[model samples]
Target: MPQPHGFRYEELADGAVVITHLERAAGTLRGPRAQQFLAEVVTGDPQLVMARWTGNYKRGNERTARNHPRNRH
Candidate 1:
C-alpha cells in the first residue's frame, strides 16, 4: 500500500493536474470522475491531464516527528 491512498484532481482550461502520493496520472478526461469534477467547462469536451506528482506525506511526518521528538513510536 505504498501507493497514494487519496488523489486530488484539478482541471485547467486545456488540461488537468492530478496530485497523488505515489505519482501523477496525467491523461485525457475520458473517464467518470474526470468529467464529473470538471462539469460544463469540460462538458463532453474531454479533459487532458498535463502532469502529476508524488507527495511524501509520510516522510514529511517523519521529519516533523524527528524535529519535535514525538513518542508516537
Candidate 2:
C-alpha cells in the first residue's frame, strides 16, 4: 500500500484533538487519548500515526477478503 499523506491535526481549546485527512475531519481525540496522540505524533511519523489513529490505513487484505466465499453477496 502507498504511504499515507495529507494528515493534520489541531488541538482545541477544550483539549480535544481534531485529526484531519485530505482536508476533511477524520476523528477527534479527547482526554488522555489526546495527550497520547500529541506525544506519539511528535516522536513518530505523523502521517502514519494519524492514519492509524483515524482508522484510515489499509491492512492489505481487502482484495482477498472481498473474494472470500463467506463475504459474497
Candidate 3:
C-alpha cells in the first residue's frame, strides 16, 4: 500500500487529541487514551499512527476485494 498521507492531529487544552484525515474530522481521543496515542505518534510514524487511530487505514486486501464480483454493486 502507498504511504498513508493526509492525516493530521491536534492536541486540545483538555488533554484530548483530535485526529483528522484529508482535512475532515475523524476521531477524538481523550484522557489516558489520548495520552497513549500522543506517545505512540511521536515515537513512531505519524501517518500510520493516525490512520490506525482513525480506523481509516487500508487493508492489503482492498484491491482484491474491490475487484471481486460480489463487491461490484
Candidate 4:
C-alpha cells in the first residue's frame, strides 16, 4: 500500500493502529573529540540538555549529537 506523506501507518489484527513519522537523516561525528564534549555536558540537567541537543540535531548539527559518547558505537 502507498505510505502517507512523511509518515507510515499500520493496523494490526488486534485493532491497534500505529503511526510513525519518518526520522530525519542522521549526522556523523568523529571519535575522541565528540566523546570529550559529551563528558563535559554529562552533568547538566537531562531534560534541558536533551531539548537543546534535539534542536541542534534538527538543524543539521549532527556534529553535536554525533559527539555524544554513547552514540559512538
Q: Choose the strongest candidate by lDDT.
A: 2
lDDT of 3 by residue, 1-73 (tens): 7889999999999999999898899999999999999999999999999998888878788889999999998
**Using TM-score as the measure, which candidate wins?**
3
Q: In what order do the candidates fall by TM-score, top score first? A: 3, 2, 4, 1
In Å, residue 10's CA in model 3 sits off its true spot by 0.3
lDDT of 4 by residue, 37-58 (tens): 3554468643333334333324
Model 2 per-residue lDDT tens digits across residues 4-73: 9999999999999999988899999999999999999999999999999999997899899999999999
Q: Which window of 10 residues has the lowest lDDT sum in candidate 1?
A: 45-54
Error of 4 at 54 (Å): 14
Q: How many backbone clashes does candidate 2 have?
A: 0
For candidate 2, what is the TM-score?
Answer: 0.77
Two-way lDDT contest, 2 vs 4, winner: 2
Deviation (Å) of 51 in candidate 3: 0.6
Residue 1, model 3, lDDT: 75
For residue 73, give model 1's deviation from the true position in Å.
Answer: 16
Model 3: how far residue 2 lies from native, Å? 1.1
